[model samples]
Target: MASTKKTTAAKVQAPIDNRETFVSLQKSFADSDMPVEEKLKTLYQLQAADSEIDKIIQLRGELPAEVAALEEEIADLKERSAAISAVIDQLNRNIADAKLAIAEHESIIEKYQRQLETISNSREYDSLNKEIENQELLRQIGEKTINDTRMEISSKKSELEDLKDRLSIRTEDLAAKKTELENIVEETAKEEAVLRERREECAAKIDARTMSAYERIRASVHNRLAVVGIYNGDSCGGCFNTITPQRRVEIVSNKKLIICEHCGRIIINPDFAQ
Candidate 1:
């Protein structure tokens, strides 16, 4: 009597509204009658697609980080520039106050001198002279303070100019870098999206158990290679380990999954790799 068992073709529905559910896709592949070789081939395709995505990500290396750093630096520069401007303003105010003090001292000296001319007593005359001397000293001190403040303002202005020049150059650099990063991201975004869709499609066709195994191996491996082909008809493609005649024949037959003993990578015939 012939076997009554029936094999059902694998049916994987595309994502609804462009939204994919990994659980549903996994269950679909798990319940399907997809052949083991077909599953391995699908895994290989997925790996290739994912590897391309990896390359795309690598191409964008450090650009985002650089953009962030430039932004932070520009912000810090602007803050420092503002602080310097504030200092300059305060120095100018101080200079103005010093000038006012000098004027007040000069008026006091003039008043004391006029009082000295009117004093008849020697004691009163001496007191007026001392008052005039004190006022003159205060005027000299105020003048010195104004001069120091002006020199400081001049120095601050020079520093502010240097900062402005530096800030301008950095701003220009940041703009160029931002544009460059945006262009690269824009170009790769479409390509990556297509590759991702292809990967998901391939994943949906693979058996759940096989997909789980492949993912496990991929995660464990440093280079993310879980599926590899025969190399030179006698060696494993992943680790370059020599394969025995029997094992090589089994791998070529593709009747079942074959793992490399040395590297634990899933081995496929070289023909299937194409």
Candidate 2:
């Protein structure tokens, strides 16, 4: 293993430019004494380890993602259920207040009617009748408020029930998916753990800029191969594109780091794969 350096590339290059540095990442470690072939070996080893881990992850067959989605849905439903509960509680309070207002209005109306019977003058009788009429209007308004609030509460409760039902289904789904995932993980756990450890060890040998470039390439490609050997003796292994004769000679020389111009994957000489 080579001593890893955290130095940046050339002063002209960004500290870590995945796009441009990918072509000639060796410049990022201009001061390193390790040969290019040795660096490519470490990078290839890292790719192998990652590929193995990817296969292990495939064994789970989307169970992990399903579990994650279910959990997210359950969380959202719980939040909505809580909000609906709060709204229902508020509406109940409104109904309670409306009922109280209706009771007060009824009492006032009763008192005004009694006063109307004892009034001796026409002016007094008119005033008592006016007070009674005002009280009746207020009572009707309070009853209408109570009716509207109850209807709203009923709607909110129905929404809450739907949310609860959905939450229950999602919770069950998450549990089942989690169990399946746990079983798959249990089977591959040992192999995956060892491969991951090897991957870290191999990655540590390479310089920072090369590692950054390799990671970016892996993420962009479907196969996740960032370092590949010469394919069928004269093609880019990653994309199967024909390599120029002159470039293939340089790649075989291994004096300088080489990459495929078409696919941008680091090209290791086929001889090295031996």
Candidate 3:
């Protein structure tokens, strides 16, 4: 009997048509009516604008306190100056009163001198002389009081002048700063508009799900990158995390969408050199 040879067929696993799947998904994404990427880009533009607005608001918020503090300081100085002015006014009144006293004393002195001519006896002459002596003493006191008030007025005026100068300088500085901030806000407006336009274009290209994922991850990630290419044996280009062999094989196959487990980014493996 001839020896019978048993032939066993090798089992062949069905090949997953990943390229076709990728191509189909690509076409579907490209043909979709909704400009997903543009929407996403618009969202980004809005977010950036909001961020800038927040910064401006924060700066503006801080400015009020600084301005208020400066204003308060100036107000206090004004109050002090007013008080000084009141004191000066009081001193002036005192000086005027002293001058009036001096004038009255001079009048009394003149009357006493005139009465000396009309005195009937030695007793009356002596009495008139004593009255003249009292008036002269009072006049000397009034003159001294006026001199002291004049000195006080001069000192107060000098101090008030310095405070006014300082207040004027401070007001000018605060005004300049406020103008600068306003100018900066105006300048940023055009830049913000351009950024918004660019972001809208970006949104039109990306799909809704992908865009959402990108935005969510972008928020969580410090680098603000949601998509990344794989390089150097399944290493993440964004964070440089070495991917597992299974994940690398899956990414290379491009069968379905795959994300980097570590960084949560869509991974794209470059074609190996043929």
Candidate 4:
């Protein structure tokens, strides 16, 4: 039997400094005397801590995102209101200029009418008459411009009022959402801190390679499970796949690391599942 001589040679493992290279950490965990059961327990504990933190975050729901959206809407409404106010201001200036032009036209019409009274011949009378008619037409055009500009300004002011009302509503919504989110965060802050500290302690006991594997599995899966136990005495706890008798014996022994072929999660003894 060639397999009879197989023996694991013990290598000198340096103390874990928490700064070992990635490959070195793997070697260190292998050479150390720590039991495989303890390593599995540490991994399970870490997962539990992380899951609790996830639950705390879930308690906040969508309040944070709702607050941000409301703030953005309020800002957009305020910007629109500012643009409309600028447009109305320009319209008022236009009205002022139109009034000045109307006054000039009226002055010219009056001067032409006075000249008509002193005209000596038919040619002078015709020139003065034509000049008065042209000035009267120009004055009417200026009046129309003033009236149209006033109407536009009135319309823009109404739109501005609507925009202001919308901005006010959005602002109030943002404030309420912010208060709700803050309350949730405040309520969970202390519990989350304690859980995170426990998480760090459990993580420190795990080798870097195994920790990396756990993180990768958690990220890839929807439920974030990286360590699980046996279920129903015959199934993988994480994936619910049926486990053969031979594989179940190996996992129960807890002498070697066991990974679920179906889900790639570390399988442990069923006692941890409780």
Model number with the top lDDT: 2
User: At residue 128, what lDDT does model 4 achieve?
Assistant: 84
Off by over 4 Å in 1: 1-39, 229-256, 260-263, 269-274
The number of residue pairs in model 1 that clash at the backbone is 0
lDDT of 1 at 23: 38
What are the lDDT scores of the predictions, listed in order?
0.77, 0.79, 0.66, 0.78
In candidate 4, position 237 carries an lDDT of 82
Question: Worst lDDT window (10 residues) for model 2?
Answer: 1-10
Error of 4 at 270 (Å): 5.8
Please report, as a residue range, the 10-residue window in candidate 3 with the lowest summed lDDT: 8-17
lDDT of 3: 0.66
Which one wins on TM-score? 1
Q: Which stretches of candidate 3 lie over 4 Å from their true place?
A: 1-51, 191-274
lDDT of 2 by residue, 170-196 (tens): 888888889889988997899899999
Candidate scoring better on lDDT of 3 and 4: 4
Alpha-carbon RMSD of each model: 11.7, 8.6, 17.7, 10.5
lDDT of 3 at 147: 92
Backbone clash pairs in model 3 (N, Cα, C under 3 Å; residues 3+ apart or in different chains), count: 14
Each candidate's TM vs. the true structure? 0.73, 0.59, 0.53, 0.72
Task: State the displacement of the C-alpha of residue 183, model 4, in Å, after optimal TM-score superposition.
Answer: 2.5
The candidate 1 region of ten consecutive residues with least summed lDDT is: 8-17
